[model samples]
Target: MADLSTLARPYARAAFDYANENGAVDEWENFLFIAGAIVNDKAFRTWLENPAVTAEHKSAALVDLYDSQVAGDNDSAFKQLLGENKGSRYGNSISYPKVSPALNNFIKQLAEQERLALLPEVYEHYRHHKAVSLKQLDAYVTSAYPLTDDQRQMIQTRLAASLNASVVIHESVDPSLLAGATIKVGDKIIDDSMRGKLQQLKTQLTA
Candidate 1:
């Protein structure tokens, strides 16, 4: 089978193009993010994988889930059904104001194709597309400790200048690094950590 990312690319691109054209990139991003999270849930995954569950049921369940989360007082029948079944396996939590028709159609298409499991990959690719379109870059920063606000701002400033684009930093801690930080922008890594330096020295000695 092809890789999940490979399979998901077209869907992501299609969704991104649609969102961009409609000037709803952020809205679509939020929708996909939440959808991806829902699909990634253990219970939801089990439900989706169940052979007995019809595709229609799965699709309806998901749509209902989203609706319940986002629907208002002027609730649809589906929302009412979800309310009645509130104690069912899928517990309700946070919700938005509405689910757009575009999102509904997108979810329906994924359901029809039995490709809902690819949502996470689709979301990742969509994010990449969004970043490129917005002239923004996502930087992953790993350090031995949490980055202070000042440090984060400094890194973002430098990265923005270097990449010639808006930079968003996501910080992570890796205590094994001993000290310092590593910044990953796309395929490139700026490894300034002590552990990285040690590895480079070891590689040189071995060479």
Candidate 2:
């Protein structure tokens, strides 16, 4: 099977192009960022994978989520159905007051094809596309735990200082790293995690 990123690229590009044509690239980026973060939750993934939830329901759930946040619909029925805002924890989101028809279809297609799980990958690809178009570099940060605002800023600042173009930090968590973090900027990767060091040591010993 193709890797998740490979499978997600076309979808990301389609969405990006659609957004660009409609003068909504930034809006799409913001939406994807929040959607990607929401899909990153383990609990939500488990729920989304449930066989009981239909494809339409899957798409509807996401649309309802955005609508509620954008419209301030305190009485959204789907919120109760989705679980106490399974996505409410994420902040700094750009709310969408009106979801475009193309955007709605995009989510629906992803759901119908059981590709919603690829959201994070799709978002990553979308970010790459957007950054390239805007002449910005993207830095990916993976850590054992979430970074505090100061930590994030420090990393962003340090990376920005090292790079020629403006850099944006995109973060994710992977507890299996055991400790510390890994940073990737374009082709360069810095593996500063305990797990990475252990693997390096093992490789040297085997050699």
Candidate 3:
């Protein structure tokens, strides 16, 4: 099978384009995040996989789930859009009108293709697109202990300067590192951990 990211590229690109054209990238980002969470849930996954459940039921369940979550927000645009498209159909494809047109169309297409499970991958790709367009980077920082506000700010400042883009740091604690930290940006990893140093030393001695 193709990689999930590979499969998601076109859909993500389409969504990004639509959102960008309408200056709704952030809105789409939030929508996709919520939608992705819904489809990725264990209970929802099981329900989707059950052969006894029809596609219509799955789509309706998804629509209901999305509606309930977004309805309480002060922004009624999404709710109105969703309501307009309620029970709307495109030759067996479920439609979610009143919500953003682009998103509604995207959801309908996913339903038609039975590819709803790809939502998370699609959201990830969409986020990458959004970040690139905004000249931003997401940095993953792993350390022996939780990072302090100063440490996070310092790393963010340095990374922003180095990358020439705004940087968002996500921190994680991995005690197995023994000490020190590792920073990951895209495909690059910079490791300064004691464990990493020891491994390098062992390699040098063996060599």
Best to worst by TM-score, what's the order?
A: 1, 3, 2
Of the candidates numbered 2 and 3, which has the greater TM-score value?
3
User: Which parts of model 2 are misplaced by more than 4 Å?
Assistant: 71-95, 139-164, 168-184, 189-207
Q: Model 3, 110-206: lDDT tens per residue?
A: 8767778888999999988998998999899999999888988989999999999998787789999999999999999999899999999999999
Worst 10 residues of 1 by lDDT: 82-91
Which candidate leads in TM-score?
1
Residue 11, candidate 1: Cα error in Å is: 0.7
Query: Would you list the clashing residue pairs of candidate 1?
Result: none
lDDT of each: 0.81, 0.80, 0.78
Native-referenced Cα lDDT, model 1: 0.81
Candidate 2 lDDT trough over 10 residues, lowest sum:
78-87
Report the error of model 3 at residue 50, Å: 5.5
Off-target runs (Cα >4 Å) in candidate 1 are: 71-95, 198-207
Q: What is the Å distance of residue 116 in model 2 from its true position?
A: 0.6
TM per candidate: 0.80, 0.61, 0.78
